[model samples]
Target chain A: MKRLTGFWAFTLLLVLLPIVFPDNYYVTVVGGTALMNAILAVGLNLLMGYAGQISLGHAAFFGIGAYASAILTTRYGWNPWPAMSAGLALTGVLAFLVARPILRLKGHYLAMATLGLGIIVHIILVQTEGLTGGPDGLSDIPGLAIFGWAVDSDLRWYIVMAVTLLLVLWLALNIIASRSGRALRALHGSEIAAEMMGIDTTATKTGVFVIAALSASLAGSLFAHQQSFISPDSFSFFFSIELVTMVVLGGMASTFGAIFGAVVLTFLPELLVVFEDYEVMIFGAILMLMMIFLPQGLFVSGQQLLRRLLARRATGTAKEGSHGAA
Target chain B: MNIRKTLSALAMGTLLGLGALHQALAAEPIKIGSFLAVTGPASFLGDPELKTLQMYVDEINGKGGVDGRQIELVHYDTGGSPKKAVNFVKRLIQKDKVDVIVGGSTSGSTLAVMPLVAKARIPFISLAGSVKIVVPPQKWTFKMPHTDAMAAAKIFGDMKKRGITKVALISGSGGFGKSGRAQSLKLAPQYGIEIVADESYGKKDTDMTAQLAKIRDSGAQAILNFGFGTGPAIVTKNVRQLGIDLPLYQSHGVASKKFIELAGDAAEGVRLPAAALLVADQLPDSDPQKPVLLAYKNKFEAKYGPVSTFGGHAYDGLFIALEAIDRANSTDKEKVRDEIEKTKGFIGTGGIYNMSPQDHLGLDLSAFKMLEIRNGDWTIVE
Candidate 1:
């Protein structure tokens, strides 16, 4: 009941913030991009934070989803929503198939394999110009529709993205509290221990991997529709790095942490306009400082402070009660 | 607790202060936003553009700026990624409230920003040369460099004039290379020539001997290699190593001296069509592009040391944009866009640009001069 109230409160705030925005530009530029980053980060958190699997090439799946929907809708004259569904299904199936051999590798080996996968995807996108529009990228992607109403405005798109994000978050939180979630945590702690406990480690890992890919695909689809265009360069190696940064900067194991991290990282560069030349340098420095000072993450730091304050309040209340009794 | 309060206060204060500064800055300057690939693989293109833009801005400001308002260039590094490019352009339009935007070093980055600029009704001038930059024609978008198709047509036409009937082709499998190949093939028959041999290699592949050997064994009189950057250099080096001494016709992309440096002695006699900036010494004094070329060459070499045709495009792009702003007499984006579209015989470093609504690409084949590397120096081949 408490979690449900909190979730409603959060959703209400997100939905109402755009109403107070001074201009449509603000909602579209800052709010829209934040929502997009949130989708990517939350999806990635499932793999890195929950499944204990790191994929540096998750953007490849995102790119595949974008290109799939784009090509299908634009070339074959299919509806955008159905094409998006097909894209998500295709990415999920692909992830499920590749997860077995890929998830077997651990640590740096896994990182390199994922990196190679992203590079190969990028190369193929660039090489196959006839279908994918080559380096110039595909333009004129159709907007999202429900029933008969088309979502064209930034506010409308933000609502779509935020609702999608909330749905995914709800699903993810549920999974985290479920039996499979416990198995994933065990596998993350120790594969040998998880196996000894009779947990199907491989199946769990593959299941979570497909889920993460689906989330990325869905986000990519949303991104494509919002931007009204798609390009291979949109899903480059750097985007993968940014997504990873969001997962880490947000407390790795916390859902709220993902949202906080996505918002900060998305808005930080825009707010620091005067220091534009040193933007990347400052971003790197902040990441380093956070890693050193608050190793757990910004979310964990905030949580620790909140806990300490609450503890002090309880202690003061107990002291007052004891004094009155005496 | 006091320290925590103080830190939070400091953070809030800094944020407010920065926001206030941006607001103040916004009111005073004619904000021009630029999206450049400033810190990635394509930084090779963006770094020069940034330097050129800085130089132009400084020069304009020294002359009291346009209409007595200082020019402020707000640049964002897209890192050569289209998604970053789109995000940067959106921020530029919505957040920075820029009057005009310019500089997309790569074709992918340029095309990504086209729709946003159009939707926002802001003027955009692209420095990249992909034909698609102007295709389907967004009202606000314009390209400074000649397209790949035009470059191919000029080169192939010249080859036909020189009686080079059977030409061997070598290209990379990348977008730029593939586009060049397509244009060359499409335009080949028009020039009454045939592709005697065609071979391709991956962009990152270091070995080109097998591809070059195939081209060498085809018994072609000349080889037309359509590639840029390191790929062309490798092809040149490999072709020399294979002892194939036929006339080597390179695409305009390899006009840079870096190609000669990379190809070493093997770069001699490589022919390509380039702007007058590459071989400024050979251009006649009466030529209309001479003064513009001289000024750009002098300023660019002083600022960046040795100007290439790429930088020449940057110089021309900046000059054309400034000229349009001056002609418009106001910072109104729509007016400036219209002024730019109606540009006729606007003397620039590359050539006289005559832009039209149907033609967003200002320059054409006539803007380029055929040049070859002779004794490690760019010289007119004719």
Candidate 2:
């Protein structure tokens, strides 16, 4: 019940943000981008933090979703909603097909395999000029519409993205609190032990992987519709690395932490834009400082500090009461 | 309690900072908003472009600004992502509320923000190269660089004059390369030139010997390389090492001296269509572009170390906008858009910009000077 209230508060904050900013660029434009990255980070956290599988090619799934929707709607003249759904389905299937062999790999081996997949996908997107429009990428993609109303403006996208992010967080929280979520935690703790304990490690791992890929696909579809344009450059090995950085920086296992991290990473560069040539330098320095100060991740350390403080206060009062009775 | 305070304080600080950043200037100057890839994969193009914009803004402002209103430039580094470019465009339009927008360093970035400017009805002067940015006439967008088709036409026209009927085509896997290759292939037959061999290399590929070896054996009379960045230099070096004596024709992308330095001894006699600013030292004073090119070259190199034709694109964008501002005699966006479209015989860094209702880029074939490298420098071919 408390968690539900917190979720509502987060949603309420998101809902009221635009009202406070009132048609400002930060709320409408940068806020939309932050929400999209948050969705991707939250999905990635499930696999990396919960299932304990590393994927260096999340951007490939993102690219798949983007390109799939872009091609389907623009080329075949399908409606935006159906095209996005088709993209999501195709991404889920692709994830399943690759997860079995890939999940068997462990540690750096898995990371390398995923990285290779990302590169191969990016290369294919670049080489397939007739379909992907070569490196320039496809344009003139139509925006998403609900019923007869078009979601064209940035302010509208901000509202849509905020609602979607909160919903994804709620789903993640429920999954984490469920029986399967316990199984995921057990496997994350010790996969061999989980297998010995009659847990279907392969099935659970593959399920989470597909779920993560689906989330990424949905985010990508929304991204394609929102921007109405995409290119191979947007989904590169570097972007995958960025996704991983967001997850780790925000506290990989924490859902809200993922959101926090995404918000920070997305806004940091936008904030640094005023710095001109010093932007990259300052951004790198700030990130380095954050990592050094909070080695366990930003949100994780903050929560740990709060817990320690509360525990110390509780124990102090209890000791005082015993001493007074004595 | 302490952490919560800190978090709130940080948030407050950021909001305050942004507020201060967006505070309107006291003098009521005309704002020129720009977004470029100042840091990223395309920084090679954007860095010089940024330098040019900054230099010109300062110079114009020093002269009491255009129309007696100090030019206040609100520029952002897009980092070469269309997404980032779009965000910056919104910030510039909504928050800064600039009078006109003057930058887009890549074709993709420009295209991404095209709908925004069109909807906002703001006069946008694009520095990126892409025919789609202006085609179908988006009502308020203008470009400075020659379109890919124009550059290809220039190259093929030269090929026709030299009686070269068969040529080998090599391009990179980039937007510029892909567009250039398509234009050349589409127009080759009309120029009576046949592309006997076609090859492509990745952007990161350091070697092109394999591709050149195939071209050497393809019975081609010449090689036409269509690409920007380090790929062209690699092709040039590969051709020289293979001892292929056929004439090598390069796209306008390699007009900068960086290409010559990268290709070293192999750069000599490589012909490419380039803006007159590149060979400004060699052009006669009678040339329309000579004086403007020399002035920009002198001022820009003095301040920014070195100059390139890519930076000249930004120069053209600003001055053309300035010309419109001067003609309109007001900061109204619609008037500026109309006046910019009325621009003709305006000689700036890129070329003589002649904007029309049908054509956004006003340059003709004369804008590009056929230049060949000699003694590690750009020299006019004639």
Candidate 3:
């Protein structure tokens, strides 16, 4: 119930942000992009944080989803909604096909395999010029429409993206609180022990992997529709690394942490744009500082700080509440 | 602490003076917003482009500003991502309320922001090279750079004059290289040149000897490399390494002296079509572009090291916008855009820009000078 309230508050904050500042570019445009990234991050966190399987090629699924939408709507003249669904389905199947073998490899070997997948997918996007428009990438992808209303403006896109992000967040919370969620935690704790405990570790790992890929795929479709432009550069090995970074930086095992990390990583660069050439350098420095200061991840540390303050202010009343929640 | 104190004092004095001037003049500075890949893979283009804008904006403001309004350069380092470009361009339009946009370091970025700039009805001057930025020209977007297609035409035209019909085509898979290759392949037949050998290298490939060997055996009369960055330089070196005696042609993507430096002795006799700025020192005094080229060359090299044609594009873009604003006598978006489209016979860095309703980028093949490397320096060839 406490976690539900926190989730509700987060959802409310996202909903009210653009309404409060409709004209603010950061809130509308950057906020929309951040929400899309949050969905990707939260999904990846499910696999990496919960299932204990790392993916270095999460962006490949994203690329598949984006390229699927871009090619279908633009080339075949398919409707945006169906095209996005096609993208999601393609990514899901591809993830399922590759998950069993790739996830079996542990540590750096798994990383290398996934990295190769990302590089191969990127190469395909570039090499298949006739289909994907090569390095310059496809353009003129149609925006999504609900009935008669078009999701054209940044504000509209922001609203759509926020709703999707909150939906994904809600799903993630429920999954984490479910019985299978306990199985995932058990798998993360010890895969061998999880198998001994009669948990289908392989099936659970594959399921989470596919789910993460689906989330990234969905984000990709949203991006393709919203921006109406995507190049191979957007989905690269670097981006997959960034997704992993978001997961780790936000407290890998925590869903809210992933959201916080994604928003911060997205907003940080946009905010630092005013600094010009020093922006990249300052971004690196700030990330280094954050990781050093709060090794437990930004969101987890922030929540702990808040709870500490609450405990201090209303120690007797909140003591039982905190005990029951954890 | 002492230096910090002095710096803060200087900042304070400038703020006070600006405040006083704001009340006295009451003329709002015209915001010339820019988004460049100043610190990314395309930094070679964006770094120089940004430096040029900053130096010239400061220079223009130093001269009592344009139209009695200080030129305020609102710049952002896009890092060459179209997604980021979209965000920064929005900030430029919504928050900065920029009068005009004067930068986009890559074609993809320019294209991504074109719809936004069009919707906002703000005149945008792109420094990227790709004809698509202007082809089927958007209402309020203008670009300053010879298209890859024009470069292909220039090379093929040069090949025709030399009676070379069969040519080998090698290119990189990057945006510039891919576009240049496409243009060459598309335009080769028009120039009565047959691409006997077609090959390409990846962006990260350091060697091109294998591709060159195939081209050599393909009975090609000459080789034309459509690429930029270190790839072309390596190709130039590789051709020499393999001792292939065929005439080698490079694209304008490698017009800078850095290519010659990277390719070393192998760059000799290599030819490419480039803006007049590369051979500014050798241009006859009577050339209309000579004075402008030399002035930008001297000014830029004096502050920032060696000058690249990429910087020249930004120079033309900024001056064209500023001149149009002055010609219109207002910073009004529609008027400035109209004036920009009306730009004629303006001799700036990237050749003489003459924008029209149909031609957003008003340069032709004549603007691209065919130049060869001599003694590791750029020298005009006919």
- Candidate No. with top lDDT: 3
Candidate 2 segments exceeding 4 Å error:
A310-316, A319-326, B1-27
Q: How close is candidate 2 to the true structure, as a TM-score?
A: 0.94
Q: How far off is each candidate at the interface, as Cα RMSD in Å?
A: 2.0, 1.4, 1.3
- Native contacts, share recovered per candidate: 0.66, 0.66, 0.57
Which 10 consecutive positions of candidate 1 chain A have the poorest summed lDDT? A317-326
- Which one wins on TM-score? 3
- The clash number for model 3 is 0
Q: State the weakest 10-residue window (summed lDDT) of model 2 chain A.
A: A317-326
Order the numbered candidates by TM-score, best leading: 3, 2, 1
Comparing chain B with the reference, what is the TM-score for each candidate?
Answer: 0.90, 0.91, 0.92
The digit string of per-residue lDDT tens for model 2 on B125-227 reads: 9988887777776788889988888888888888888889999999998888988998889989989899999999988899999999999999999999999
Report the backbone clash tally of model 1: 0
Model 1 residue pairs with clashes: none
- Predicted structure 1, TM vs. truth: 0.93
lDDT of each: 0.83, 0.88, 0.89
Tell me how far the alpha carbon of residue B279 in candidate 2 is from the true structure, in angstroms, after superposition.
Answer: 0.5
Error of 2 at B129 (Å): 1.8
| DockQ of structure 2 | 0.64
Answer with 1 or 3, whichever has the higher DockQ. 3
lDDT of 3 by residue, B295-335 (tens): 99999989988888889899999999999999999999999
Query: What is candidate 1's lDDT per residue for B1-382, written digit by digit as tens?
Result: 9999999989999999998898687546778888888888888788878888888898899998877778888888877877778878877887778888878888888877787887789999998878888876779999888777887888887888888999998887777788899888888888888999989988789979998888888889899888877999898888889898898888888878788899999988888887777777678898888888888888888877877666666776776777788899888888999988989998776677989999887777888788888899888865
* Candidate 2 chain B: worst-modelled 10 consecutive residues by lDDT: B19-28
